[model samples]
Target: MATKTADADLKTASVLAFERKLDPSDALFSAGRWDERDDPARWAPVPVREKSVRGTISNRLKAKDQDPAKLDAQIDKPNLQTVDVAALPADADTLKVAFTLRVLQGAGSPSACNNAAYQAKLRQTVEGYVKAHGFIELARRYAHNLANGRWLWRNRTGAEEVEVRVQHLVQGAPATTWRFDALKLSLRHFDAPGEMTETLDEVAQLIARGLSGESHVLLGVSAFVRVGAGQEVFPSQELILDRDSTKKSKTLYTVADVAGMHSQKLGNALRTIDTWHPEAATLGPIAVEPYGSVTTLGKACRQPKEKQDFYNLLDGWLLKDRVPAPEQQHFVMATLIRGGVFGDGE
Candidate 1:
């Protein structure tokens, strides 16, 4: 006869298997309510990161006055271009999920035991839970979208290449929604060696929490796990440059100059409404007089510190303005080069 503890372990394992196969389409076991299935189009798969660039250099000399021995040396600069990360997009998100398990024991529990049946049961239960809950469909959608979209992978030779894969949700957005900005799933077996029942219980609890519209549970989990792993995850809002500091300047060319220049160039490149804005109308062609002179904007502006200030200013501009779409942000960046914002030897 099986011991009570053994029976409990087997039962827990069975529950875990069931949880694994639970799909979103599955009738809610707790409430016994079945919701209509959602079509794939209801959600958009996250974008993946897969952009790259390549560079090449060449040089030559010119013969002077038809003298073969007398030649003038000319150094050719290297050319840089964005390499197609083979149909990869430029941005994406990532999601992670985790599970943890522990075992329960009574006073009469066996001291020594190995349970293969329990493990198999746990796997089956978890699989069932996941499937019945529509998780498989969700994962499949992400994989399909990512594979059909774009991805960039770096080759062993250091050349960046593009791969087709779905982006993982890394951060942002509340948990519980079908579309997660980011997710983390973890599974751990605790108590007895190789005992996975507790971990599966934890997973079930998380799924239930999610189904209940409890966003904070996942957020707490993310924070706890990240801290335990010694990782730092800051909010996106913090990444934006501070508004006050970004507005001030101590150089001849103000932060406004850099921002204005960036905006102007971006406007031209993206063909942003030819109808001039009051800001652009007032500042006409702040020309690069010498076509490459660092001193065009004066000595104070040429300092490395001031150069950094220009970047900060541009960042501020990007955060505030809606003149150019986010997709065209790179065009604004190009203005830095055109304005000789980095001075010579950049």
Candidate 2:
């Protein structure tokens, strides 16, 4: 009836613990979403160490090396070699903290990436820019003056003649000048020979058609023989326009014959059309061989009437009413239209 009088007794169960080896790959601990899991919250937050005494010692050593003069001012009665890592915060990780110290010590001004090849390329590009822009400016000036009918002169001898002059201001007292009369364009006092030569040649061709009178006009470079000391003369290369020899006796052509020669020469130089093609006209009158023989298709075609017709056709093609082929039409239209548009824009 007393329920066997409860005795103070306690029973304890035995606990068993087992250790398992993890696979080499599975043993990895990631700080963030290092797997395919997109949820960043699933990853354990990385522990941020508050301070490191080892890092401070390393920083002091680095500072001493970097600025020895400033180190004495910063720490009086300093024992930089005896700085202890145990003095730092409890959560400090020396290895990671050392990395920060190294980073700070290594920081300085960025180094230049200079090399000979790169410098040469840069110089070439700058030179190209100057040359190109200079040519463009020259062309623009010429076109503007032409449009304004400024300084346009006619050939007194009747042979087509147009002259262009470009003067470069030289820097010197008692200034001396070098003159180049190529293609009837005079370049004076140009320091850069190559640029001056190229520019003068181009300008000369531009005005070649308008200049008529002589058998050959100056082109490229020419040497002017000075008659006396301190007297400079310019000798320029001449571009000649002569008729085929076979037609010399048949036609009564004069200095006026070179009217459309410039355009022909340009077309030939450009190689847009075959030389044999009648449409492939020269800027000047056709060249006549010494004995008045005309060369056509490697055959000597002799006739005054044919020569006259050839020149007439050329003139028509250049200035008069002649429909250009589709290719030529497009080329001509594009050039003329662009020129007109640019003129308008200016």
Please name the candidate that would achieve the greatest lDDT relative to the true structure.
2
List candidate 1 segments past 4 Å from native: 1-54, 57-76, 80-197, 213-218, 221-346
TM-score per model over all chains: 0.16, 0.16
Q: Please write out the lDDT profile of model 2 over residues 105-180, one tens digit for every residue.
A: 1001112223333333323432443343322332332322322112211111121222222222223221222243
Q: Distance (Å) between predicted and true CA of 98, model 2? A: 85
**Looking at candidate 1, what is the lDDT of residue 149?**
16
Residues 1-346 of candidate 1 have per-residue lDDT tens digits of 4744554444221121111111111000000001201222222221212233434434353345335433222123334442211111122111111111111111112122244554444234333433445232222221221221111101111212212111112254333322211111111101112243343334334433433234223211210101112111111111225646542211111121110012232122211111111122443222221121223345222123432233333333322322233212222222321222221121
